[model samples]
Target chain A: MKIKNILKGAVFGVFAVSGAAHAADVTLNALFMAQAAYSEDDIRNMTADFKAANPGVDVNVELVPYEALHDKIVLSQSANGYDVVLYDVIWPAEFAQYKLLDDVTDRIDDKTRKAVLSGAWTTVEYDGKYYGMPWIADTKFLFYNKDMLKKAGFDHPPATWEELETQAKAIKDKGIVDYPLVWSWSQSEAAICDYTTILSGMGGQFLDADGKPAFNTGGGLKALQYMVGTINDGVTNPNSREYAEEDVRRVFSSGQAAFALNWGYMYNLANDPAESQVAGNVGIVPAPGEAGVSKASAVNGSMGLGIPTKSTHKEEAWKYIQFLTSQKVQNKYAKLSLPVWEASYSNPDVIKGQEPFVNAAKTSFAVMAPRPTMASYQEASAVLQEALQNAMLGTATPTDALNNAAKTIADLQ
Target chain B: MISYRKTVTAWLLLTPMIVIILGVSGYPLIKTVYYSLTGAKLIAPDLTDAWIGFGNYIRALSSSNFREAIWHTTYFAVISVGVEMIIGVMVALLLNEVFVGRTLLRAMLILPLALPTVVNAMMWRLIYNPDFGALNALLVQLGMLDAYRSWLGDPATALDMVIVADVWKNFPLVALIALAALQTVPKDLYEAATLDGAGMWNRFWRITLPAILGPLSVALVLRTIEAFKVFDIIYVMTRGGPASSTKTVSFYVYQEAFAYMRVGSGASYALIVVLISACLIAGYMYLIRKHGEA
Candidate 1:
């Protein structure tokens, strides 16, 4: 009886050890945006690759629209939710202030920092702390239909905003399309991006030296005037007031508009014969500058992947984020969004099929402008969006609209 | 002894339901009330101790944005519910008739009601698409429109368009309820009305109207509440764009608490909305009681 008991105890010990090993498996829930930049399938596939390398870690991915991304991250803060989350460039200040994201400053080494583009670093930094890994280095580019330009007797895409307007006028006169330009000027963050691009191109400043509202004057006023002028002149699609990036893509892809201001993702999609009607006729350029202000314009529309502070599986989440943001993974999927790594810009594989995109990226990235980084950015951006819409809809003049926005934003501060 | 045991057993049976109600509804209501008076942030509710009495409520009331949102909500509720009531009764009256395809038509009415609101909103979004939307295409083809125009994009028509979508999805529910009520109305009343030399309109106003008023009022109250708290359809369709023309009180509250993380002000806003809803309910109940007595 004693011998049988010993053998049974030994078998139970083996079972206990195996159960402990099995319990080591970690399941992580990661959140990503469904629209623009990298596609949902690309995110899932990259995660799958990460899982293959790290056998013990399993990831569950959830994708929401860009408009919902900020709220989702903030709402899930206390729920112990989202081990890994994709965040926008404007969120780091707010997130860092709330301590919603883990400070991974030490995790990013000097060698890695040196290799990554310096501008991309700003996406994940706030108050000198790194909140995440910058994943998408994106900007809005000028997309034009080559056929329409040719039909309008223009040999080259416009090099400046004035030239672009002239070209648009030519296209409209030739009856190539009813509206020669379409923009994602909807009352969302998208409108802010386009405004920032134009504002920067016109040498406008978002704030004065003391961080006061300054956009209502100087180049800011010009940017709004320029946007309103396009609509008033019947060159810009009036429906653009209601359009987001996707709507702009649809209108441009369907050959309804000759020129569209959209993100980098539109390039490959607009050129794909399966997706766009005028695929081969697509032309890419950096958003045009003003004559004396800038050579090219772009918004620092990058995004990052971060580990939520509430995550219990922080180590595993960091591993997944690192794998996703690594140069190899980013370069492989550079068709939709360019890599943040400086060397990837010169990689033949990244540039082979999309030469114009690569060339435009080279110029645009250098001049990419940022929206104001503040904890109240969301509210301020809302005010700006409303102001932009009111001006565009002719409910208020640009001066009055921007003045109101400045006042509201000043009150928020 | 038997009576005492019965009382004890009943109390034991009711305890679980009481606990559940207190846990789900009571706890949250109390917490929301507590948070409304404090300057609490959404991220860390426990850390807040700044109790600024009624400050948030004052701010919310004085804000022009909040006032606009309230107006939008009221407009949406009144128009959508009013249209829904009219169309619902007409459809119910039509379906209640002894027609060959009555049963099939009744089943088909369930299709719109059965679809999820998000799916309905998405479908309507496509139908209203500026470039290739069916509505624009149809209107242009029929010569009702000179060109394709943005329906949801324009502030003048966006809310109305959303109301149209809401009405399409919800009128079937009212129709179903009204139809059920119509079945319970006796044939004798109508025959008596006819014998009394009543016209078609008179019979409808005197006999059918009174009989169905009770169920219709219930539908009215339910739909009014739903429409006043409208968020999902607007979120899916517009995200309250084109200059926030379609932004309702609930969407405003959502933006405050979740998007902006201002939990304190958000709670106050929510309570204000609740107060408005309560007043509406009370008004409805008073009217309903008067009708019942009459």
Candidate 2:
């Protein structure tokens, strides 16, 4: 009888402990990239803030290299590897199509939805549902060396493609720089991005309203012609074809190029006296468009935060997302990235040191175009990059290259 | 009856290895074959269990990109392997002779082989950089040209430049193999040839050449197989750029699978390549067997 009573007491104790453990607070895992714009300390501080605001929740953040994040997401889709996922702009539509992301339409409040920039909001929308929240709003701007422009006797940045060529030639003729323009035209994702800026400025479309390949239209040929003409006219470096975006920024920062087209982040990096030779001699402006063709020159590029569809801690993840994207938190985020919240634009802290970006963004945002949203965007962009490379290298005429790419894309579909 | 029992016991002893080989290699091969006949994507719900027999194979075979890639891959393999073999033999011959610091020279020669292929590719990319690369800087300093030429940006030179990088990374392996073979060659043969009043050319042609052919053929086959599947260097340095001049079969397969996310087509493309490779390897084995008999 004593042994039986002892067993009954032990069983009661085990059940009581399990019940207590089940009542503990929830924890959520987040996967993000350790890019130049978002550091580990930023995530750590944000997690701390979120934890303080919600005493019953804990957050775990896993940061990976930018190059590995895409493959990681693709591999982790089935397992819902993380409760929250940070992804590039190109990913929302594709991830949503594969049912890898949660439909957070109801979770986002109307006021919060209306607070983000329209261009950034569009990146997170697909098939009439929202899959993510925009975290950073990015777009390219024309960066020029003020000393080189002054040496060439130009008081302002070029406003048109014709004027750009003329100014570049003047700078080249004066021997201010061997190449007046340096571009990120390497045949990879960067090349396609650079091409999109030119294509949009020339009023060309990558896909028509019917969603067919339309980049080989008249405007497309003209854009390619202008790009290749720069090399033929001795205004841009022949080495441009081999350079990625960082390489172009490196050239401009070293006071070697009269002009460069890069993302807004380049402004801060190029002005640091320790890293740049022409720290204070830099001017930022809108990228030039062809005369009477287009006023829009830049493309919208950004990353978003989302919850995976299979996550079990949806409530906790949503709470953390709201805390991280709040105006106060985004205001702090602006130090490392452009603010996604439109109201943060007028924040004195945001505009204090980044006047050029703020001013340029006002115009750029109004005209920013996005790359085509497709499940197979990687393949599509690759075809476009190859076509541009073929035309630039003189291996194929612009018409032939684009036409071939059109056929290939049709096959891919 | 006793012999039959012995054979059964032997088969039972080999069961674990057979099961392991089937589980590791055979399972994946069969799954790949099955997937090639189905409509599959690399990610998510699109990776379904639907049958579309031979459709992916037909589409890939008819694609222009695949055709161009086949030609480029073949050309790259032939050129890179041929050049690597010739240079490897010459280097091996030179290193085999008694000289000052022979051991140091031997170690230095294999350094490129020891370095990772990805690192070698990146180093070559820096060297080929037109604006600030060592190649252009050195050429300009030597007054060889008035301007820096874009080596990788031009279509005509991109493939050749990639080939040079591949050769630099792989030729050392072939040289090391030839060096090992050279040590096996008897010194008395050279002495015998010299006593017979044979010239240096005759001595080398009659003795060294024949003695090395056995190992040289093995090296050639190995290098050829490796060159045909070249991907990392191409992926890094050129990415088959300047007009798809360097896109090898493996790179094409990778683009289809990961970039295009078309697992079905990628599997079909891979199977076709495997078929071709199997035939080539069979021929190589036949040649090796024939050489051994000779």
Candidate 3:
């Protein structure tokens, strides 16, 4: 009888532990990129805060490089994949087509929609439906060395693309820097971002009314020509053909380049004395536009956090995303990436040390151009990346390269 | 009846391994072949509706980019494996001799081979950095180079640079294999060859060469298959950049399936790679059979 009693007690103990686990504990897995925008530590701390507020809910975060982020998200879909994934602005069409992300249109309310910046909505919106919440409101900005400019006899930063080139030439002639300009023109999405900035500034369209390739002529042709011209004139760094965004930042921060085209995250890092050699000499401005086209240029390089369709703990995952994108959380960690909420721009804490960044962002966010939104955007981008590299490497003329890319992308459609 | 019982027990003991092998590799291989014939989307729920036989193969064969990738893979495989074999045998012959610190040198040879390919690739990337790399610094300081130049960034030198890194990490493996084969060669053979008035080159060409050829060929076939499927090193080092100059067949398949989300076409490309690897494997089996007969 005593042995039977002990056995009954053991069975009851196992039941009690498992019963408690099934009731309240929900662990959500989130996938995030390690580069740019929000730092990994900030995401972890924010997730920790969310967990503290909601007892028995935990978030396991995994970070990957931006180049590997897309593949990881897709590969994990067939399995019990990530509950939450951070997606690039260019991926919504592809993700929605494949049903990789859950449609959260009903979860997002009008109040939240109105609070966030209008441009940020584009990051998660596809086919008039919302797939996720925009967390990173970003665009490329022109970073210049004020000391180099001053030494080259310039009082103000360039206001147009031609003026920027003239200043770069002046800087180069004055021996301020061997390569006055550095760009992320490597054969990747980064090169596309830079190309889009110039193309948008020159008033180019990626597609026509019938969704045909339109980037081969007019302003698109001019943009590629200008890129090739800089390289040919010995003003742009030759090594930039292998550079990505981080490389551009490194070259700029080391005082090797007088001017660079990079994202908003570089503004703070480039200004921090601990991280940059040319800290105090860094200056920020919107990317210059063409003489007759526009005032400034930018590309829609934002990212969003979404729940994948295969996630089991989606309710808890959505809660975590909401908390992370909440105004309070975003404002607290606004050093690296600015918040998507429009009201946070007026918040003194957000603007205290980043006044120039905020000022440039105000202009840039309005004019940020979107890359072509299609299900085959990745393939299209690859073709364009090669074309850009071909032109930059002098293997083909800019016109020929752009035409070939247009033909290939047209076939992809 | 006793022998029959023993055979039954043996079959029972091997059942788990057979099941495991079929589950892990056999199932995936069959599924890949099935997917290659169908027009399946990677993320789609239903895969039964889209079947287009031989279409993906034709498309892959027609693409210039895929053809270029095949050429690149061929070039990488031939050069890296050929160089590795030559260097490996030389190192093995040298180490086979009576020398001081032979044990220490053998241990050191394992270092590069033991390092993970990703780590090796990353180290080589840093070493090849155009602006501040150790290579450029050394070359400039030695008065061999006029200035710092991009090594992996230029299309003309990127693939060759990657080959150099691959050889560095993998030649040690071949050396170790060759060294083991060399030890089994009888001391009497070299003594006999020298007694017959053979020179160092002749002895190496006749006795040493034949003794190590069997193991060396095995290493050659294995390295050839591996070098043809090179992805991680290229992925980490240059990402097929400066105009896709270093893209191999594996990288092409990865992009087609994962990046582009065309599962059906990607499967076809992957099967083509497998077919090529299978051919090499068949050649390996034939060589081994011939060696056994000899």
Error of model 1, residue B31, in angstroms: 0.8
User: Which stretches of model 3 miss by more than 4 angstroms?
Assistant: A1-22, B1-12, B45-49, B291-294
TM-score of 3: 0.96
lDDT of 1 by residue, A1-413 (tens): 99999999999999998888769888899999999999988888998899999998989999998998999899898788899999999999999989999999999999999999888999999989999999999999999999999889989999899999999998999888999999999889999999999999999999989898999999899999999999999999999998889999999999999999999999999999999998989999999998877898889999999999999999989999989999999999999999999999999999999999999998999999999999999999999999999999998999999999999999999
Clashing residue pairs in candidate 3 are: none
Q: Which stretches of candidate 1 lie over 4 Å from their true place?
A: A1-24, B1-9
CAPRI tier for the interface of model 1: medium
Candidate 2 TM-score versus the reference: 0.90
DockQ winner between 1 and 3, please give it: 3
What's the CA RMSD for each of the models?
Answer: 4.0, 5.1, 2.8
Tens digit of per-residue lDDT, candidate 2, span A11-127: 999999877765897778899877545558888898998899898787888998554576677767656688888887777767877788889998888988888888888777888
- Residue-by-residue lDDT tens digits, candidate 3, A49-79: 9999999898889999899999999999988
Candidate 1 TM-score, C-alpha based: 0.96
TM per model? 0.96, 0.90, 0.96
Positional deviation of residue A50's Cα in model 1 after best superposition, in angstroms: 1.8
Candidate 3: tens digits of C-alpha lDDT, residues B1-294: 569889999999999999999999999888888888888778772554288999999999999999999999999999999999989988987888888998899889999999999999999999999999999999999999999999998999999999999999999989989999999999999899899999999988988888888888889888998998999999999888879989899999989988987888999999999898899889888988888799
Indicate which candidate wins on DockQ.
3
